[model samples]
Target: MTDSYRRQIDKLHDDVRRGRLSRRDFMIRSAAIVGAGALPVLPFGARAEEPASGGFMKLGLHNASQNDSLDPGTWSTSWTGASFNGGVFNNLVEILPDGSVAGDLAESWELDSGAKIWRFKLRPGVVFHNGKSLVAEDVRQSLLHHMKPDSTSGARAIVQQIETINADGPETVVITLTEGNADLAYLLSDYHLSIYPALDGGGIDMESGVGTGAFLLESFEPGIATRLKRNPNYHKNGKPYLDEVEFINIPDATARLNALLTGEVDFIQDLDIRNVSLVERSGDFAIVRTPSLRHFTFDMDTRVAPFDNPDVRLALKYALDRQDVIDKVFLGEGAIGNDNPVASIQKYHRDLPAREFSIAKAKDHLAKAGVDTLQIDLSVAENAFAGAIEAATLYQEHAAQAGININVVREAADGYWENVWRKKPFCAVDYFGRATVDWLFATSYVTGAPWNSGWSNAEFDALHKAARAETDEEKRGADYGKMQEILRDDGNVITVAFVSWRDAVSDRVGFGEVGGLMPLDNMRLCERWWLKS
Candidate 1:
């Protein structure tokens, strides 16, 4: 009777094919009872428009560090994730533009009675770029690659719940989790969890660049560019309309915009919100704006000095004028954040009063922490977000009234993510966000996660665990709400603003709907876009 119930019915067709239930049984048990027959045919993004077939497409993006490679686990930013996933890799599952979960390598997945064990039926005929056939073992090995404690992939913590993985047959993979998690399907769609072929070493060959995606890797120059050509044998029919694709790194927003205007690139992402009007007025360009869960924050290392105090964290939260940051830094293109990772666009988002910008409240909390003065260093780079440095300066000015001095550290754009972010006691971070609440938490806020930014709360953790296993929609939503409340008042990170996935583009690029589920049209632009004549 709900959206999720409708989704379950959509998979009923797969259920019928897998011999799990007869047509009559499926119809009687859930389909007809949930009005599946009356459900409208809803497709994510543009599915009805006829796609044009040829042309070279190039994109200017803010991601791509010199540390990049063909390895999926080493992919840390938009450049690597987009280039690799959009071109050369495929996950077990994918989050479509409509925010629904669908099979990528896996044809269908079924849950056991306890919902703790899940079995996936691999889609036949899917093959790696190397011409090797995809099998259940490849899926299992790729998953295990992320589960190891030494794994540095962003998805490591998300998949840590897996207790065991078994290849039931050549086409079947069964995963048993330590606990019931209905959210596992969406979790598998994490960008860092790309499936790879198992090699003779009992592991995947990371540098091969062999994948089951629409493009084959051509050449990669770390921190410079990446070139790829279409994989003619792509599984999707009539896909990868473009013959070639390239991703160029332009860290400065101005440089990226200039490249598009100068005909050096076909599309450019992470356009500064201030330049939105300029791009829109340009006769040769079009604005590609997508409302998204993307949010930027200044992370405070809770394990470090001063920030270790809860009162200090609260004081800093009240010192910032979130509206000013949105109006000036974001150019009024984004909404104010509530100091939580779960954006308002997501499910289980809590509706609460905005944290006020008041020096009095800030001073009050500072006094409670027994600190007369707070001097904090904030690491920042424009690459962190559209106007990260400008926002930090504004925050510094406002905090002056509350007896707080913020020393903003400007780092090089090339290695901001690797050098400044989590390594610094206070720094800036931009989250492209996830399709679900649990994925967001696990990636950035879970205890000791690689990007945890040193935030940990026992109460929040307990509630998160409970919410993951809760089958009742209403109760699960309530559990997540309580978790948000804890984060709102006690969390270390200051979530300042949520912005649209705004990009400035030449008229050369054409696509159906540009999705905001992740950066660069949900990392599928390579397969979904074509060049305009």
Candidate 2:
């Protein structure tokens, strides 16, 4: 058998072990690959094939700029998200390929008798890229770095519930929470909690790029490209097989697609839905498409005029034709989205009926709001997400039927996040999605979350907190369902579609066996992938 087919089978075998792959699907894939005569009998639990390491892989990605910082708290774009989390960093814990929590910097953990206090045992002998030994104090300090009173990090609202954090010994760190959080361990895997060596002044050095990940930062030029070399002293025995990697920022999707086709880049994060067939016809590159938690939205500043009125928000929601947007913009590669952040795969995501696209209802809601005809600025940019400009244009046309005049304001791609996103009264945006419902709400829906929630809805905040504190999974799920319902009808956000991640990759790269939790193979492609040649 060819080495490439073996790698694919290896991943399939692991999935079968993890209960993620169905037996029927496995049999079909297996039957299609190799015939019964040429060693067709596949044995279970056979992963003896080790990957061939050493080659450089260039990546083309989107949504990066000169404002990119090494600070974990400031990673808003996928360019930075994949670079920081996938490259030069490690969390205390991580979600495994099979969707279970596992230790990264931490070896193990246990809850105190009250379950409100948790203790994590650190892995000794691990050294940062700066050569500082990983210690309990460093973990505690790294976490506390996000909770500083004057901090503006998106993670601030997440770590605020921690009452105290202290090192119990040279190797043990303890966290005391004001209340019990059943999902605390999952929270630690938040990409913002990347562990870093502490400075002598009781703070982390945000300016320096130092971490304990599988790769060391060779060079980082924001909005341009970053280079890395394998860390010889990395803790994982045989990981980060690639000897060198480069992440190049290519904002324009056509240029990015051409780059991959011409072999300038081995992979790119997003593939324009329009080009899926063209790339397939070329056959020079392979396409990797996976269902994801990512979603697109048209957000409003609920604190501002027109949007502040719930009826206006409802009218806009009714004005949206999700199916039409999916067909025109997404090219029918996405599922419909409710007005909530929770994906259908999430635990508490209820099967709420889709909101009908009715121009009459939209006009009725506008009349109810005491507004005869409304003209609003609807800002859009390519950086918002793939197909954002086209989506906004479609929305503009749809709103016209309801007597709403949506002035489509096209913005520059470079500074949209800083200048247009939350700064504008309304804009188009996207979310990579959080691992859990609590984390999702905390990032966008919470009252003061740094990611521009715009609305200060008291009931949603209370329900979110109560759900987080509940220990029973069933009870917590119920509370989270209620929170989603409130946001759907009464929040300032209108989720238009949930998109699938479609990546165009060179056939040289291989992901042998893995559960892709986040985009780009849980944002660890650099660490887990290898060049077949």
Per-model C-alpha lDDT, please? 0.82, 0.82
Worst lDDT run of 10 residues, candidate 2, spans 39-48
Clashes of each: 0, 1
By summed lDDT, the worst window of 10 consecutive residues in model 1 runs over 40-49
lDDT of 2 by residue, 1-533 (tens): 47667677767754543234543466677776666324343333112346768899899988878888888887777777667877898988988655578889899999974568999999888999888899988888899989988887768767987899999887999999888776788888877888888888797867778899989999999878999899999999998899999999888999999899889999987889888888878656777665557889999998899999999999999999989998888776777787877876566777788898999999999999999899999998987889899999999999999989999998988877777878999999988888788888888888888785578878888888888878777988888888888989998889998765678888677675343447776777788888875
TM-score, one value per model = 0.90, 0.91
Clash tally for model 2? 1
- In model 1, what lDDT does residue 133 have? 95
For residue 411, model 1's alpha carbon misses the true position, in angstroms, by 0.4
Tens digits of lDDT, candidate 1, 1-533: 56776777657634432223333455465635356445643222233346788888889998678877776776778888788977889988887766678998889999995789999999999989988999988988888887777888778877788999999989999999999888889988878888888987678878788899999989989999999999998888898899999999988888998999999998998877778778878889887666677888988999898999999999999999999988787766667787877877678988878888999999999999998889889999979887999999999999999999999989898888888878999998888888888777777776877678788999988888888888899999998888888888998889898777777777666778656778877788888888765
